[model samples]
Target: MTEQVVTGGGRRGASSAVERVVATVREGVKTGRYVPGQRLVEADLMRELGVGRNALREALSRLRSDGFVQIEAHRGASIRRLTREDVAQLYELREVLEGLAARLAAQRIGETDHRQRLVAALESMHEVARTAELPAYMDENIRFHRTIVELSAHPRLEELVDQLQIQTFRIQFRSAAANHDRTGMREYSVTEHQSLAEAILDGDGTRAEDLMRRHLRHTRSGIMQLPDGDFA
Candidate 1:
């Protein structure tokens, strides 16, 4: 009985270690610490994450399932790089999902403290935009969208949006980095974000949806215009 108990505890500990590795790797990819197509050395990951080979492999497997990593037969694991077609397809889905999230948030704006929170998020975006720091602006930009998703009060919708956002994180970061010098584009994005916030605050579901779709469409256009080398 004691052996069984110990075995169970070991399993839980291993699971926790795998989770830590997974979260760290995911955050690394999102923050650009791990760029697309970069090889992931198992020995390095094991050392850095302080996990054993088995736990590291398990974490990599989970990441692979989530479309964050790719394990080629002989090439080992590497960050998954999105192709041009992949970006286009992801944007197409994002438009629908995010638009729906915006509409739902607008419809439910008065049901909770979402109003205050959303206003705060928009203000944060404005403040970050003034700094002209790409990383801060990107962080606030993601926060603003996440606030709207939370306001939607739909668990499944939030989960779906979160997954899609994670998958596109690298692409979005790269696109933004490439256009970091385009001050006009940054200003325009902030303006559109304000317009989106207004629509949601006013509880105009239809307008909120329309604006969200339009915002994503413009972003997609900009990403498409990037040099061919940007995509796989």
Candidate 2:
């Protein structure tokens, strides 16, 4: 018995359905609610989401395009399994995207609103870090990076960054969930992220980009170094 909340219909509801389904599935993937290479049967998903086959498949199709799920000829849609190569490729692309975002953010970051958002986000991360809340730290980790990308003030950049983040997240989430040394990682990441916020606030895009690229590089290397199934 899957409990799904479905309300509204027609034009307005259509867009909302897609977002709701995507968020639900993304959360499941991030938290290991669905395992790596988990086969998603349409019928089972329909029941689980309390949505029709069409809506469920639409969501799956979007995720497929996003690289979160792969649609193979015979295997259908399954969660993507990240190889070392995939991890390398994901971080490589992320470094470029984040670097560009930071560059753009430096010139465009005059708005107090964006600054406030970043400050608030960093404070939330500090609170979680003090409590040693790994889950909270991880969630804030995502928010912090995304907030920097959002500062680019370019819709297209924002769009591309969102997709790239999703692709990178699949690998990171899987590895971190299983890594035994991840608690220490949380602390390290918290400090690095706080520095990133300060850099952005200083309006030094170059430094921000440098910090982001360095962070991505270090993270990718560390995750790759971890023993298989040792990423908790």
- Report the lDDT tens digits of candidate 2 across residue range 40-145: 8877776776777667778889988787788889778887766677778878988998888887776667885887877888888888777855566667778878
Candidate 2 stretches with Cα past 4 Å from truth are 1-23, 173-184, 228-232
Model 1 stretches with alpha carbons more than 4 Å out: 1-4
Give the clashing residue pairs of candidate 1, or none.
none
Say which candidate scores most in lDDT: 1
Cα displacement (angstroms), candidate 2, residue 48, comes to 3.1
> Per-prediction RMSD in angstroms?
1.9, 6.0
TM-score of model 2 relative to the true fold? 0.80
lDDT, residue 179, candidate 2: 66
